[model samples]
Structure formats: structure tokens, C-alpha cells
Target chain A: MDLATSGGEPERFGPTIGTLGEDALVSGVIDRYPSAPWLTVGPGDDAAVLDLTGSLAGPLIACTDTIVEGQDFLRHWSTARDIGIKVAAQNFADVAAMGGRPHTLLVSLTTPADVPAGWANSLADGLAAECSRAGAVVAGGDVSSGAEIAVTGTALGTLAVPRAVLRSGARPGDLIAVTPGSGRSAAGWALLRAGLRDVEDPVLAALVREHRAPVPPYPAGVEAALAGASAMIDTSDGLVRDALRVARASGAVLDLDPDALRPSADLLRAASVLGSAAGSEPEPDPRDWVLTGGEDHALLACFPPSAVVPAAFGVIGRVRSGEPGVWLGGRPFTGEGGWRHWS
Target chain B: MDLATSGGEPERFGPTIGTLGEDALVSGVIDRYPSAPWLTVGPGDDAAVLDLTGSLAGPLIACTDTIVEGQDFLRHWSTARDIGIKVAAQNFADVAAMGGRPHTLLVSLTTPADVPAGWANSLADGLAAECSRAGAVVAGGDVSSGAEIAVTGTALGTLAVPRAVLRSGARPGDLIAVTPGSGRSAAGWALLRAGLRDVEDPVLAALVREHRAPVPPYPAGVEAALAGASAMIDTSDGLVRDALRVARASGAVLDLDPDALRPSADLLRAASVLGSAAGSEPEPDPRDWVLTGGEDHALLACFPPSAVVPAAFGVIGRVRSGEPGVWLGGRPFTGEGGWRHWS
Candidate 1:
């Protein structure tokens, strides 16, 4: 239904959650989820059942992420569907980062009573759609009324490889590489913060959409692991900050190349638009977004020099023996980096 | 470490979440979680790994439940520890309702930045305590800043029996029974609402404690399933409303015996306190509380006439093949029953 753009639909303003009641509202959303072979029992029961009767090769991977209104996103900038998509993407990306295949998710939402039932339904639809895209299914969830809106998802995955990837596996002399996308979500956030919306330029509009909802490189994670990547993490908190995490965990120094980390052309153009909004000032450096912006959920991994780096990955740095830290162009780069909650 | 009564502890007023930062706050809580053999990977990684290496039993059971600050509880009434215990108990009860043994859980908490860090630590401790009680472990979770406090838990359980006892399996000749607890939580809520706190009466004070955190009979679920229960559900929404659900799902009529459904002595005493608070009403019928009170999380199951009901269960009703509804005292019982969200 393209709920992100269907702001003018009449039914979008239908009965409120209070008027519709919890059961009917839950039933409407649960019906939208497509059934899967692995789901032995669906949402109507006390608990959803997953058919894990056969012996598993490896361990089961699980991760959870949450998004709250006015904290992670602004209500006017991100629609209900955008919120749903972004929350699902972040959690699934975590499983993917572990060299696992996501199979199921349980999402819960707490909203105010005045919220329209259709908005909640759209959120579920968006969540379900993304699950299907990732070859996973929505197994079950809970809904309740609260003072503010908050959505959480716990994603479960099965490891395809015998051993799951760990961030502490990066060793000295390993090469650091990242999947194609990075910094677009940060650029989108900049545009939104600058009071720019409904931008006419396709590049600018796309950036705005990315800010609202990001498409993480889900498949690249498994591909990297198959290709023998040493350590892995999803770039939820910019390249430098997240890379610093791997470096600290592995007790090695990560030396990043400046030329290889240049901002994308779209980000450069976005900086231009944001710069003009403030009169008589030079363009804000797009490199900040490239090096420090987060939420792209790109797979940042360390690979052995002897292993075949996946085709989708771009080699951007190398691991060296030293005190654990991150360096740019052979020097320590001290710039404000990525998002942190309650900091 | 009894957080509910340890309000005067100096550490309880320690640094706020904003000052502590997300990583430190998360680490403090994660450190409290005891590791287990089944947990292949713990909380520090991008995802947790559960060692489901060999599986020959039934499917995996999953369920999620959420509790909000103002909707389900008030901050003044429920301490952070009480809130944590209640939330964990509710999710585990759902798993138990499916006749599964809970093994792991992922809890997510969203709260304002100004909250005391100790409050969050206490919450995690409480959750871990309850998980231990249920023979489970806290595998992973997420923490974020938000406008208000909301906690959600996704519990994972493994079935012990070959088949799950569903709510739709009741036959015409089945006997209805419930575990040895009900109406305590509702009675507790009434005491709290009447501005009664720290009562001299030990019995009344216990009811207040129950409202804050009611314990569910976790073992009885598996006991019912093992004893060949035909239909089962947790009484999260009063006895009659939940029994009605079982009846509607099984396409049968549930005839409840009111004589057997009498309120416990604690409830009768609580009603006397509430009736006195009104100053006029003659001890408002404790029978209403027995029939309509909710949140005790007692397991209600239908058994065959010959099935040896578990020793812990009290027989309260029978099933008959007629219109799908609930009857009491040989007539159609039509009194208002149970709790419903956003009604």
C-alpha cells in the first residue's frame, strides 16, 4: 500500500486504537503476515512455534533492537512504515553480521491510545514486507498502549557456517573492507534537519528517503563469511567508530586510507544543499558524513590477505600491530563520531 | 539487594543514564547475567548464540509481552525491580501456557535519559532473578533513550511434549480446572487504588505486593500437558473472559461452578478494606473479584473426565456441547468479566 506516501488516504484516518480495541487491531495486523513452512503454529496461540525439530548444524543467533519516537526519529520526518522498516533492518542486519540467515522475528509496539489503527497496521505491514524481503517471517508480537510510541524487534537466525563471525577475530595484518553503502542515512538526516523536504532533485530526495528508511546490505554479510572474512560488524555507528570497536576488541590498530574513504557524489551534493541553507558559509565537509555518519548498516569486516574478499566489498583499510586504535592517513583522526543513545 | 524495599540505599541515587552512557550502562547489566552451557554466545556480540545443536522434540515456542509506565503500572507503585519481575513473569507465563520450558529471553528497555542508572541495574537484576527461577537465562537485549519507560521481553522455550496443548482442543466431556492462584493481582490493584500503603495487616500488605509482582505457577503448565490437558490458556484477562476464549475456540460451552470459584480469604479481606473506603457499600461482593479479576496469570486448562488432574489444580468447571459461551451456577452467567486493553 506504500504507507509511507499514503498520507491522504481516507481510511488512514479511520478508527483510533481506543475505539478499535486491542484484539481487533491485533487481528488485523496478524492477518497481514504471510505463513511459512517453519512456523508450526501462528500468532493466534499463546506463543508462536518454530519447527526446529531437526538437528541444527550450528548455534541459533538472536539479536534485538528498538526505535522510539522523538529519540531515534521525528514523527513528521518518518512515517509509521519508515519506522517499522528501519527497526526491522537494524535487527536483521545484526544477525546477518554474525554470518547467519534470519528466519523469524517477534516485534512489539507500544503506542498512545489516540493513534489511528491504520497507522499501526501500516507499521505491521512494513515490518512484514521487510521480513519477506529478507526471507524471514513475522512469528508473533505484542501490542499495548503507552505514554509514547516505541517499537522493538527480536530477530532469530540460523548460522549457515559452522562458526559464527566475531568482532574479536580481527588479527594483525588483516585487511579491512566494507560493503558498498555508507553515510547515506546521515546525509538524509542532515537534509531533514535543515528543513528541506519534498526536494525536487532526485539525488536530494533519495537522500531524504534513505534518512527515513535504510536498506542494509543483508546478503554481503553471509558472502563475506563464506569468503573467510576474519571479524565482522554492521556499521550502525559510522565507519570510524565501529572500526575502532573491532580494533579495540582485537587489540590491533586500523589504518584507513583517506582517498578510499571519500564521500559519495550524492553526499557531496547533499552537503551543497545543506550549506546554502546557511547564508555566506562554505559547504560543510561531506567527509564528516563518510567517516563519522552512521545507520547505513554496512558490513565492515576484516579479511585475511590470503582470502578472497567478496566482489561487493570495497577494501578501505588494513590492520597493523600496535596499541588498539583507529588511524586515518597514518595519523590519529579525532573527529566527532556516530550516534550513542543517552549520551 | 531487595530493590523493592531498598529505597534508602545511597547507590540508588547514583548517576543518571545520560552521564553513564549506553555502553557502560549495558555492560553493568550484562555483567550480572550468569552464563549457561546452552548460551553459546552471550550479550557482548552483535547477536547471541543459542546452542540448539541436537533437537528431536517439538517446535520452538516464542512469545513477547510489553509493559508501559502509565498504562500497565505507575512508577510510584511499582519499583524498577517489581516492574522487571512482572514483565518477565508475564512473558514466561505465555511460554508455560504453550506447555514449553523457557530457556532464554531477550529484554529491551526504553527510558528517558534522566533515569537513575541504579534503577536500570535493579531492573536487570530482577529480570535475571526471575529467569533463574524459571530455569532460563538472559541471552541478549537492547537499551535506548525515549520519552517514557517501556520494557518488552521476547521469551524462547522448547516443548517437552510431542504435541502442544492448544486452546481449541477441548471436547464436550472435558472438565475445567485452574492452577492454585487467581484474583490476587486484581485485589492488589484495588488496595493500591484506595490510597492504602504499608497497612498494618500482614494479609493486606501481601495483596499490595502481589499487585506489584504476581508470581505465575510455571511448572503447572507442563504438568497439565503431561496429564493430557485438552485445552489451556493463561488467565491474563480474568477467569470468565479467558474461559470464554477457550469455549469460543473449542466450539463448546464452559459451565463454571460458582461455589468452587469463591474468592480466597485474602481477597475477601481486601474487599472489606475497599468497601470500608467507600463508606457505604456492604462489603462489595468478593465473588465479583474471584470471577472477574485478572493478571494472576493462573493456568486454566480443560482435562478429560478421566484424566487425573494435577494435584496443584482445582477443578472449577465442565465443558458441554451447546452454544459457545460461559455459564455459571447452572444458568447463563452474564456479568462483566476480565480486563481488555484500550477498551
Candidate 2:
């Protein structure tokens, strides 16, 4: 399917995702993905430029994220479409984490030849689908034959006006707010790990989708930065862990309100069956899961109490200048809420 | 240790790699590999831009390549550093293939955390080292933990006063000139596969290095475009196979002069020593290795007879408006030196 003229007279193969050339693949995907005005050059150029939307007027905030099969994602649970969106979402999430809106993207893939044509084109489809979903364009990419499937993307974003709400911006009086309930990924993982057969819960299913692809609340990122968010972080690592990065960088004390965070304790609903089977409620603490679950990708921002917090943002705690670290009560949140690269 | 400020850190691990968060990593790499004056917002932004050298600006060329474990390389034979340099080289070579000078690069790595600190940093060092060698900078990258190590890079390039010499531009009557020989990678693979240890020949060692980390002639790419070359290609595949790409794209007949390519036959000296022991000068032809051996990454171009061909570009044949395919000795060259992912 050559968007430019049907890829040299399309010879069957049921609407070929694209002709078998790297350039053709790029053209196919780029045709599907919308072009953003900030892109000075799109897919054909060596590189692309996104007008600087840095917190400061001139500097642009940039980030890249590469997803590898069997490493960042598993083939069994996610579709090629999921990966396409996930790759874009993850990278753009980084730009958002820095308080910038993602503008342009460059993608590249390495795969074995035996791999079906659609698998790659579908990845392109996923990339285009997600880029369109988020208002960005696919700029350029490379294609090569390799062992396993690997996808890498570089993202460029503009800060419209540079006032980056960095991790270091949190202050003593800042009120810590989480945009949504967490532990969805952790709860989802429990369902997956238990190999729950005959599962029927809708929320459990939603949690599973969240684990496979963490659709970041991007508007919230932009809103948080614009609304005087002192510091912000994406809940990539466990909430406490990712939050601690902001806390550590900000040199502020983070105090959680367990009472206010009760909604985040929905882990047991999904894990209830497993907990019941274990005959001990699995000691499921939705708080623990919310604090510990990695990949929730929710936006956590610190703001002054007077700041107009959005209705969507769930107020979790307050900040005070003190020793760096995160707390559940007086003690630090421990274990799974933090990332362990190896150990 | 930073090249700018090497030894001021606290704990001594391997190198200060994987030490920074994504933002700091770019800042750190850019801290070392600073951009030129034309660079507007080098590493901190979403994307980078360089001033075009002249009004006769060559079109921007882009390409991507990904390398993965158990597929592209044997970790035992090559270090992470070797892989890093090679990956950058492979992608940058494509820009060179387009008859453009590589200008900037973006890298993405999916690394397993357990992979030692030394290994990861060495990869960064190798990237910095090789990009310097190519006069390019590592602009930005993405990092994620994966099951297998995968690195993908997008290389951006500048076209000087001359227009780009594309593979599709080949016309009938253009003389075919290959910069160098092939079969080096085939030879290198044989050596590594057979566990023949290291051959004493410096050229053979270089051949192994070529297979491991190829340095494409960047100048030659620029030269071909400037020299009025009708079409150009990089010899990632063997000579005959890439010539066909030019053939198919330009819809012109690519004819090779076997006698003109005699200089390339010198590559068989070492192969003959091993081949004789295996009985009788290898298979159909030992020259086939040099003629068809892919991965030598030599540049090949078809220049107009009146076109000023450089001494560096070895003239092997000419192009004719005949059958849309490559020829040797006035007959169809059946050798498939082209790379196939599965063989």
C-alpha cells in the first residue's frame, strides 16, 4: 500500500502494508500519520526539527525511548499495535515529564526477514495510529534485518513557553497531587501472574490494558506545567519511587494522606480471587500496590495549596523541606514501589 | 569520567554510564560531544538542526539500523563497545551511501540491567569515539531494560553544494566504478565461525574488523555527488547485488567489466590458503567471494564517461539502457550476494 500511488501497481498480497523497501515502509507509515506544523522536515530528511516549546522560550526539551521485544514488552500479551502506541507513548511521556508537549518523532526497526511484512507495517500502523492520537508526526526512520524485533524512537518536543516544572521545582509548602488512582498495573500484574482463568471483571480487564500500554495523561502534563506545578513526575517506577526522584531532586519532605488515597486501593477487587484462594486476602493493600506498581504512568505533581488543582487530580499529600525520601506514614515506603534493575 | 571533568565523582564504578536519568544522559553526552556553530539547540531540545552549507543544498538523507543479540553479533567475539561503534557506523554509512556527509546522530539502546556497568559505558564510549571519527555527534537516545541488547540509531547528514547521487539516478552509458572489494565480511565470518583463531595477515585482521565495525568512506559519498556521478550505492551487500539495486531503481542495465575489477581479486589470497586445504580453490569461483561478499560496505557509483572519477573510485563497468538487471561479461550475473535475513 503505497500512499503515494499504490506501491508500484500493488500485486495482490491483500493490500500490502508496504513494498519491501525501507523507504517505502517509511512513506507508507508517514502517509498515515498526520504532519505537525512544528516539523520543519518530515520523514524524508536526515532529521526533523520541532519549534522549541521549552519552558524558556528558546530551548527545546528532547527525549528518546526505545522498546525491545521480550525486554520492554512481551509478544504474548501485546499486539504489534500496542507496541506502536506504547513506544510513542513512552517517549512522549518523557517529554511530558519535562513539561513539554511532544512534537515530532523518528522511528527505526530491526527485524528478521522471515518476519511477516504486516508485523512491521503494523508496527508502523501502530506508530502512526498513536502519533495521530497524540498530535505528532513520524519524521524519519531506518529499517534493517536483524534477529529479534526491536523498535526505537527519538522524540522532539517544544515547551511553547519554557517554564519547565522540573523535578527540582518542588518546595516545602507544595501540595502533592496524583492525577489518578494507581496500583492498576500492579493489580493487573497479579491477575496475569495468577493466570486467572475465566476472569470477568471489567476493571480487571482495564487494569490489564493499562499494564500492556500505559496511556499517559498528556493533557495533564501540559496543564500541570502551565498551572504552576512546582515539580512533576511520571509514575513509571512505583509511585513512591518515581515521586521520591522528584522529592530527592527537590530536597523536600513528602507526606502522604492515607485517608485521601483510599480510592487508589482497588487492587483487591482484581486480586480478590487470588487473595481468596490463598485464604488470607493475600494481604492486598491497594495502597501498597498504588505506591509500588510500576507502569501506571500517572502524572504526579506538587503544587501550592492555593493553586487551582484540576478536578481529575487526586490530592495525595503535602511537602515540607526536610531529608530526601518518600513516606507512607512517618516511615519510608519500601520494596516493590521502587524499581529494581536487577536486584 | 567526563572528558570535560573526568575524576571528581564519589564512588568508582566502571564509567559514569547509566548513572544519569534520561535528561542528564543527553546533557552528559552533549557535555562531551558539543555541536558546531550551525547547531541550534544541540542536545537539550526535541531535535537538532545544522545550517546547509550552500545554496545548491543537497537533499537531507536519513537511515536507521538496529542490532540485537543472538542475531547480529556474537557477544563473545565482540564487546559491547565494539557493537556500539559498529551500530553507529552501519547507520551513518547509509547517509554516506546517499552521497551526503553525516552530520548528526540519534541513538537508542535497549539494554539489560545485568549487563555490567563497564559494558554499558563502553558502549557509550564507543559511540562517542566512533561519532568523533565520523565527525558526527550522538545527539540523543532512549534507554530501557530488555531481555536482549538492541541498539538503533538514526543518522542525519548534510549535502554540500552538490545534489545527492541516488541509486535511482543511474542512466545508461554511465561507467560503473566500485571504490573497493567485497568478500571481507564473508571471509571474516568464516574465520569466526570456524574458530580458526586469528590469522596473521593484517589485511585479514582488517577484514574481520570490517565485519565487526565498518567505516564507510564518508568523503567518497560527498565526492560522488560533487563529481557528477549518475548513481551511487553503498556496498553493504556484495558488488553485483548492490549494482542490481541501482539497476532496478534507475531502470538501466548495469554492466560489469570483470577485467576492470581484477584489483578486487586480491582479497582471495587468504581464502585460497584455507580453500586449498578444503580442496580445489573453493566452489564455482573464489572471485565470487570478493565480487559477491556483502558487508564490505564499499561505495559503488556509476559515473558518466566524461565525469571526473577519482583514483579512490575503482572503475569496474558502465551502465547501458538495456535489460533492467546487472550483467558481468555480457551475461546476467546470477550471483545473489545480496543479504537475506534468513539465508
Q: lDDT: which candidate is best?
A: 1
Q: Clashes in candidate 1: how many?
A: 0
lDDT of 2 by residue, B114-147 (tens): 5555555567777777888888877666566666
**lDDT (Cα, tens digit) per residue for candidate 2, span A111-229:** 65555555666677778877776677787776666556778877656564456667778898888998775878777766766665225677777776677667888778778877778
Model 2 residue B206 distance off true place after TM-score fit, in angstroms: 2.2
Question: In order, what DockQ does each candidate have?
Answer: 0.80, 0.23
Single out the weakest 10-residue window by summed lDDT for candidate 2 chain A.
A3-12
TM-score of each model, in listed order = 0.95, 0.78
Query: TM-score (0 to 1) for chain A, all models?
Result: 0.95, 0.84
lDDT tens digits, residues A172-229, model 1? 8898999876888888888887777667899988988877878887898889889998
Per-candidate iRMS values, in order, are 1.2, 5.6
lDDT of 1 by residue, B21-135 (tens): 9888988989989997888888978999888544523578889999988878787787777787888889999988888888888999998899889889878877988899999
True contacts kept of 2: 0.30
Residue A187: error of model 1 in Å?
Answer: 0.9
